[model samples]
Target: MTSSPVPDTPVEVIVDLLTKAQDIASYCDNMISDLFLAGQTLKMLIHMSQAKRVLEIGMFTGYGALSMAEALPEDGCLVACELEPYLKEFAQPIFDKSPHGKKINVKTGNAMETLKELATAGEQFDMVFIDADKNNYINYYKFIMDNNMLRLRGVICIDNSLFKARVYLNETTDSNGLALREFNQFVSNDPRVEQVIPLRDGLTLIRRVPPCKITDDEVFRGVTGRFILDRMRLDGKVAYVTGAGQGIGRAFAHALGEAGAKVAVVDLDGAKAETVVEELFLKGINAISITADISKSDDVQRMIDAIVSKWGVIHIGCNNAGINMNSASEDTSLEEWDKTFNVNLRGTFMCCQAAGRVMLKQGYGKIINTASMASLIVPHPQKQLSYNTSKAGVVKLTQTLGTEWADRGVRVNCISPGIVDTPLIHSESLRPLVQRWLSDIPAGRLAQVTDLQAAVVYLASDASDYMTGHNLVIEGGQSLW
Candidate 1:
């Protein structure tokens, strides 16, 4: 499929061995094309995906297996299946000679039986490469799907799908070519996956959609599709954001809405929340407003209940409500400290707890808490002991919750942002403090609300499923100082 010439550089140990295997194939009059380009492509994909476990349906002289194994991390592994015992015998010694050879598990016999055994053992793979018998391609796909051999969001790459370009001959009687055409059509018609044919011989890449049981209509009829970027789009997802009347919270609400989420904008000021909802509706985004005092458990529950009643589920929760107070530590009153803690720390906990209850039942959710640069470093020319401590508590809360809920499929992460050019920091009274922050910040400018948009989307989407207990810092190098 790939006509590009192989690089003229000296071959690696595995490549050299594969070259020798090619000579063997010629002597035996066996039909085998050097899969050097495909092997290289697989290596790049393995590295990009950080894939640890791979399943290969065919292994000829261990070229493809070795390529993927070499790209994998030290603890990574590849299960290579070859139907013929002779091929396995021929490839085993070559695999044993390479540094990554030990990573390859040469399994001889029928690949279908091997897949069934792996499935029965509850084994899952980050990627599955199918390049064995042509007649069984459709059966292999069905087996993989029915048995859940691939993990949710895992990839399946099928090689030689074009069958030497004979699949296009309408009147041809080639059995292998006809079988490939049927397999390609079957995969193309599958609604549960989004696929692409990247190479000439039809290197088809298929990605299983989210395991949350999203319907084909929901995936295909909406803005979401098989495109990698589209996977980040949160179509049909319901999102809730606190303090959405203005500033960073407002920006988060808008960003999530733009990404196809139905948003609930919660604010203490009922009028302000409704105003923001109206603005969202003007942009054709599905949104609602809920007035709640986030510090109060009753208010928080009511808000969550209202959102669930309207949308049936909560997929994203942004606990962004908090009050800031600036006073010298010695002069900071107990009332100020308690109030800050109640709103910033206690409010965040209440939101996470309420959301966690629903998400734990659903087995999936993303929680984004708004922390601050104060959580990591003391700000210059500003005395806000209570505020700094409250934000620090937020970071700890996020990490603790993230660890506890990770296995439950709910992720809790916090964003620590530097001084932003928002109303909170750009006031006349805070002009001197803002200038001091700029001097310490290497970026020489305060972050805009838009700067944090992509980070919020990343943590809120399925893209960050494996990431939890992490505090994403968007401080423009201020904390580095």
Candidate 2:
């Protein structure tokens, strides 16, 4: 939802700074340590560690200094020490162009005297970078440790530790190479945690050893972890699905049974419900069938009683049975309006109340209602005032029961699905209506019954324990348009 941050300058200034630094190195009489990617590396380290106060012992062309400063917070500071005064003036022009230039304080003098001055000033740093003369590497590290100049969680980085691999191979008699070899040995035996990365010319990262270090046996003492996949499993649960004869209800029943719950398929058509139960049996799932019309209050109560008698408990109640009658607003009959509400909204409420009693007594249950995308947006090219209003009422009813039952160990939530490709919509008369709907759907297609399987399982599982009073809309971005 948020846009990428714009650069504080007119151009990609970091790349520009590196380009200018590389050009200056080519024309200069003195050699600058511009070979390694120290600028970007230090910048990444500063951002990761959130280092507010940085100490850069040697900043050649001010490229690394400016990079570190850029990563710092607005009020952060970086102290750049150097042995020569002329190099400060050479890099100052580039620094002045940067917004972070104010964060850098260039100290021109002998490096050791500047370190002593900072120590006496009662200063501490979150990060310390040492890339100066190799001969004084040990002395700089020693001063930092002995004076307590580094914070307890501070990081100290040493560049060029391998010294062109000469320290490890011992192939050179050069003074800088020999000094680096000794410094590497000293750090290897020190009481700290360190890692040497072969990033260009050996970058060594060191941090203070943590006290009370973690042990293998203590990793999971008196505790266990069930990861996301395990938490999603609905093992040892009992579930019953209304209108499980076919379509979305059939899918929800099969999904719940496949997830290790004993399932009962309820429907007004006894033969169709038995057929679906037979399909579940072929898949080695334990299931039963019950005939009941949810629109009747007695039938709804009988449906819940039948499930509890078979499984001894009901853990999941899926109220997915509903009907829609398409008609013009003015031409819609009172019979059609009442019929839609009786089955869609009133039946759903009856099922919720009956199942909610058993769940409240047992201290746990999940009820999932099947609402429609029509509850959110008016379906174009067709008018079904009663159907749309009933579905909207379903959503409101779900929110009310969800909040009321949440504290009593019963969770209620609704799913609003887009137009689905089913046998009911596979007619010649509805072909033009389907085409008009596809244009409104951003995905350019209708949702399949299988497409909504995971959503039902998520609501029925322990994974959605923290969620309540929610309307989960799965409309393929149709409602947005």
Candidate 3:
């Protein structure tokens, strides 16, 4: 598997910037908005550190407004314009509570009219963000320019430029798309502003100048999305990985252990258990082996008991052990169906039940369940009715339990992967036929174990704390239909 991203100064610097922003937001007593905007602001601050004065043309509940203001230098100032009169009362409480309230001016009234007045008032800003009135995007940009409020080298960000792919269609059109299309073309030929990078929705980054040149830095700057996956790691957490013996299980055990998690390497095979422990030891992560079939109630209870006895608490529990059987529904005897469910579904139930009890007590936990893409949509060429049905059960089980326990702090989520290139699929007897079956996949290939690793880590980490009761389908978009 590939190594995790290297720790870098950029990441830390962004973190520090967010720390200050969060402090400001918290100080203002708008912790909710601060908490919500923290991630987004940290990402934006990473792009342009030299940014000072900022103008946010729309301040709804003061989230984006306060976030940008918190990132600016102490000498920097931010101006926010809100069209609604009562928003000041709604957002004022948070700003008044914030220590950096002095740095921001929230102007109440129609955004366009207020922006027009800012131009008349001879106000200039180094950075401007326009996220108001979708149909009036072009109008907002023109007004900002005609007033000469944008300084040379200043950047203007226009949000929601994509309109959820609606703008790209030639038919079933919208006035919003029409206006956005005109704005995109107008900016393309305009003597001022360079670079437009579409994020979710879209983010157009424009640098003001005569015959504006799109610098490599600006191009890179517009790719402002936080590598969200990079945020998952045990930097200072603990994890328990089941079936942590051979194959993909061992890989996951080693990965989490190497990433600083104190791993509980578990398996039904005693020798394999010890082998994983040795591997984790070599990697310098604290580890212990427990030989137990995860599906057994007695075994799961002992595992949990051992874990709590040693570590005092569990942070992440990965329910990942599963077996496969290939048989037509007619040929698949009741015995075989029971055997499949015994390990896949029943085992998952036992483990989650045991882990859920502990996690519920702790009041904060992440349980990452492995549910194959078979749970989302069935593969066309094969029929493993029992396996597919069991996996689907796991998906709903996660969702149901997640909802039941959400208010208590334990978040349960599942990952559904498409045909993964595991040892199970690569067996000498099966590889040839499996390769032929892979042709039906639009990605033209099977997924790698490493492909599932990130999703597992995210579901088990703080990055996905607010997410639960969801099946994160990672099947190369195979189930798109």
Winning candidate number (lDDT): 1
Per-residue CA lDDT of candidate 3, range 61-168, in tens?
A: 666666676667778888888888798787776666666556778898888888878888888988888877777788888888877888856888887687777778
**Which stretches of candidate 2 lie above 4 Å from their native place?**
1-224
Ranking by TM-score: 1, 2, 3
**Deviating ranges (above 4 Å) for candidate 1:** 1-225
Question: Taking the tens digit of each residue's C-alpha lDDT, what string does model 1 give over 11-34?
Answer: 255454445566656542232234
Clashes of 2: 0
CA RMSD, predictions in order? 14.8, 16.0, 20.7
In order, what lDDT does every prediction score?
0.88, 0.85, 0.77
How do all the candidates rank in terms of lDDT, highest first? 1, 2, 3
Clashing pairs in 2: none
lDDT of 2 by residue, 1-481 (tens): 2233544551245444444555656542222244325667789999998899999998877777888898999999999998888889976766787788888899998788999999999889999999899999999988987788888668889988888888876568888889988887888777754545646677788775443435534232211345465577788999999989989899999999888888899999999999999999999899999999999999999988888888889999999999887889999999999999999999999999999999999999999999999899998777889989999999999999999999988999989999988776766666679878988999889999988889889999888987877889887899999
